[model samples]
Target: MTEHRPHSATTAMGNRHDYLPAAGRDALLPTYDLLTRTLGVPRVHQRLIDQADLRDDHKILEVGCGTGNLTIMARRSRPAAEVTGADPDPRALSRAERKAHGLPGIRFDRAYGQELPYGDGEFDRALSSLMLHHLDDDVKAPMAAEILRVLRPGGRLHLVDVGGPMTPADGPAARLTLRGHHVAGNLGDNIPRLLREAGFDCTEVATQRHRAMGRVTYYRATRPD
Candidate 1:
């Protein structure tokens, strides 16, 4: 299910960056939801939402929110919360916007995780699901720092991504896709290490066995008060 659908974008400073599409390919974009659902991402999304402990008036941000599945779910789970999902993929954002057309208190933005378009301390809570591993190694820390900057003091970040030591139960594809250089270093304790380097006090909260994603670890990273 791992697709290396790479795309390019230029920042205001004229720096070019690459990003992977939601489905790894433009042709697979339409079926992104189907693939995610088949992989039990919705269930993982709910767990992340539950951990977020959303409240009324909370400004929630989801980074790399492909197609808005988790955004829509958070909006539905906490109607009073204003939810925003940011991603670099326009086609995926379009689909997300359409899927959330009738939903109030929710919106999608065309932006990258590392270069969020929002103001400092603009959000009370942030969520990321299976999106961290999609980033390039060099982009990881900056994205973490960006998340820290956009969150109010004491705000919490709920994140889930591929991680941990590999096991025999993991399939070959999962091992191959997740063990890539860009991905391998981002796994396991390195996640917390990355967040901590960005000034967040992070702790591993839970872990799950993904059918095709190897071990998935959940972490709660808190911006200091």
Candidate 2:
């Protein structure tokens, strides 16, 4: 169930600078790992799996599967499930493939969120963990559309990212911090809105706080059957 494929150029529309620069991203892998560990990434991913009810034949897709940490978790928790990890960074995908060696039902692809390389209605579930904050402002809706396009009717979508509903008092402060990071910061309850606009029905929007990443939202949505 594992396959490796080449990527195209246009797929990287907005996320051409996932972490500022390509070299910086490759160099920060270890640091990012450390940060995740300190921020209780395992518990976060476990919550993600708990939110998803995987079946014997569920085919799972992990968007922005950096180093495949969440991807590995999903595969291990549901060994029978078919799991495919997609990312635009070949360096990250390379590490993901290396980490998933000998693991059946887990694969990696060099693709972007706005341009997934799969057929329509090919997956039962799709998950994005702590990666949406890296996307550029304009790519949000397009990425959601691609997710919806590749999912079958009634397929589920799960997203975990840094940002959520903001209060009137939070408007200015949030926008300032977001501008500094070159990320939209979502400053609003944006993920669910984007998914809803892309034809998915959002069922839940939960929040958690991290010492370093601030407020993070967990979105659970489903395609209309």
Candidate 3:
């Protein structure tokens, strides 16, 4: 998640929507990076990038790039690839741009997931991490559709996020705090269903208990040629 500004920006489709701040509040935005890192987000990001299998000539997009931690990692991992990060929050985009400074073939854009400014079939792969849960259930489907629309034939969407209910394997504190009231019903099953409905062949690649996020899952969604 990224920090929100007082003003709103219109999407390419002329739709205006408010964005959730990085930490769910403007006051906590500064701690978003630290909190995500503590929750092992960096490791998950690396796994997502590896799953994307970036090629040197590939053009990739990172939705909800926030502070750009994952975006920077992907860019560095494949320096020859073109990396574009899209987020609605200007503050977060600023942080991302600064962090990604001097990195060739990488840029940050101020845009929302459901209304990306890019042309159709502009990207080879799209990456998202811990972003879907922040979206309202209704928005998730359209967001998936938009991602599918932006990806070229045979392109893939790499994602990792809260999947379903927590278990004893997750820390007791996490089980208590990560109840996920805002999480969609049957998230583990629903995400793939949404992607498939959006015309991608989707699969749950992995699942694990996180120290802070409860049960998390990884997905690989490919757009058919």
Candidate 4:
């Protein structure tokens, strides 16, 4: 059953993308953070890190470290580990770098998921939260291959994004609002098989949630030795 509330206002422009296209990233950063909090991002990031299982010596990379929330968390969790956050957005990267000040082994750089700046087998684990869906259908496989290429044999890629449809219980308004978001696209595609074809061995998948996002999925895939 839908949680009872005053009917969601402005249900027509229900998602951040609608706002983003009009006002741009500078205006929407806080809005983005607010929605992330609504979806319980701290809890989400915690679970994501737990699933990552970082080793003491692990060299980790976050492919789309947008506001650096997860990147910061990963660095804090393993102070000795080398945690690097690379993103294509200069504005976001600058903000993340500032927020990550004084953290040893945490660096931010401008880079895209498709053509990462790192050399092969340099990292023990890679993370991409809510980022894969940005790539077009033809690009996603190559992006996955790029991620696989940067990791060492057996290196793990920990990811989370939208999944299949919402449960039958989900309200129509909820579904309509999320239509253009990353989750919807993922649910419609054969992501695991794409990863497998990209040379990753799909390890695990499970349904999880964010406060703002109704239904998302977690995935773990590793580069085979």
Candidate 5:
């Protein structure tokens, strides 16, 4: 079994603004796409996409789509599926929209993960990548519930985020990198339990370690049919 580690931190009470400065934000827009494409980190997202067994007719929703990298990938992977990417950052949404321009059947919206602006059971699959760590339990727990709420009865939720290695001591820098984000520094520990509490059965938990900086953890859960 994978070891779980929890860290303590103060949760943000209300909607928080992006920490990146304007210039930094602008720079990140293009850099994000380049890095994800070059390093194949987005493959983590791809794994989730593949696990969902997304069909051309499936309606998919991506929460916290950084810059449409995964959104575009999903659209291309499932040409017949209607894909929508939502983010709380307006700048990120703009970048996503620009990246997706001229792409039919794909759209981007400005929204929060904790409070998605969509109807219940509206999508066949709901996904999030590298976004949950930015949220606290106050946000993440509810966000998981919201993801389950928006997914169809038999739909699945795929989450990709930073987590510990097979053991906490296996990777030290991962904890530091997460601390740098000032979000859920070490919250991956609660994911499974949280999913259970949110009314979903976590079907799988997979992990991939990066040199020393961090490891990626992916969770696939399903709403009861």
Candidate 6:
């Protein structure tokens, strides 16, 4: 398993300019594909995919789809399902679009997790992976509400993000990382409260070791029927 390193100080600073030079971006296309493709197949993603119970008639939305790693995997997992990948990063979207080009029944869009452009009750399932830690509750709470608004009654929302007990040993490192970018609020402690406030019934919550030193936590909930 690849270790999940903290983003560079520049990326941590949230400076879009710090990402990479255009030439560097061009160089990373192949690397991005390899990483996302491999990561998307792991047990964690498979669990979320199973929970989604995708069907031919389902309209699935993937927020912060990044380079469409999970988007393509989702399509492959449920070939007949309609899948859309949304991300605020144009560069990432471009890469995802290219990867999705020859694949039918899949699309990419420019959108933020906090503000989705789709209609009300337009989707059967909404998903996000590895994205929440980058946002605070002000952004994530409203985004969670928006996910519910667009989901059909009884539809599900599957989210995977970083949340765990930050030990005293981790405290200094975690704080250093936070100086550059906001880690997703600790959903491990807050997800249940947030779900109830959003009017969704929490169906499941679990944590698993992701790689060597990091953990992946998930929350699966449903809109009331």
lDDT of 5 by residue, 1-225 (tens): 112122332233332343221123454555766766665666676787787788999899998786777888899999889999976666767777887888899988766666778889999998887777666556667678889999989899888777634344546766566656543443455667778789998854677876543677778889999
Ranking by TM-score: 1, 3, 2, 4, 5, 6
Q: Model 3: clashing residue pairs?
A: 2-22
* Stronger candidate by TM-score (1 vs 5): 1
After superposing candidate 5 on the true structure, give the runs of residues whose Cα lies further than 4 Å from its correct spot.
Answer: 1-27, 37-39, 164-172, 178-189
Question: How accurate locally, in lDDT, is each candidate?
Answer: 0.83, 0.74, 0.80, 0.72, 0.71, 0.69
| Candidate 3 Cα deviation (angstroms), residue 168 | 5.6
lDDT of 3 by residue, 76-147 (tens): 998799999988877778888888888899999887788788889999999999888777666777788899
RMSD values, in order shown: 5.4, 4.5, 5.0, 8.9, 6.9, 6.8
TM-score of 4: 0.82
lDDT of 3 at 20: 70
RMSD of candidate 1 to true structure, Å: 5.4
Give the CA lDDT, 0 to 100, for residue 206 in model 4. Answer: 68
Clashes of each: 1, 0, 1, 3, 0, 3
What lDDT tens digits, residue by residue, belong to model 6 across residues 8-86?
3223333444232212354564576556446543566777787677888889999878788778878888888999998
- Residue pairs with colliding backbones in model 1 are 5-24
What's the distance in Å from true for residue 93, model 3? 0.5
**Per-residue lDDT of candidate 2, residues 23-106 (tens digit):** 244456656666778878878888888888876589999988878889899999888999999887777778778989999999
**TM-score per model over all chains:** 0.88, 0.83, 0.88, 0.82, 0.81, 0.77
Q: How are the candidates ranked when ordered by lDDT, highest leading?
A: 1, 3, 2, 4, 5, 6
lDDT of 3: 0.80
Model 4: pairs clashing at backbone N, Cα or C within 3 Å: 39-211, 39-212, 162-183
What TM-score does structure 2 among the candidates reach? 0.83
Tens-digit per-residue lDDT, 25-115, candidate 4: 4566656666677767677778889999997699999987887889999989998999989765566767788888888898987766666
177: Cα error in model 5, Å:
3.4
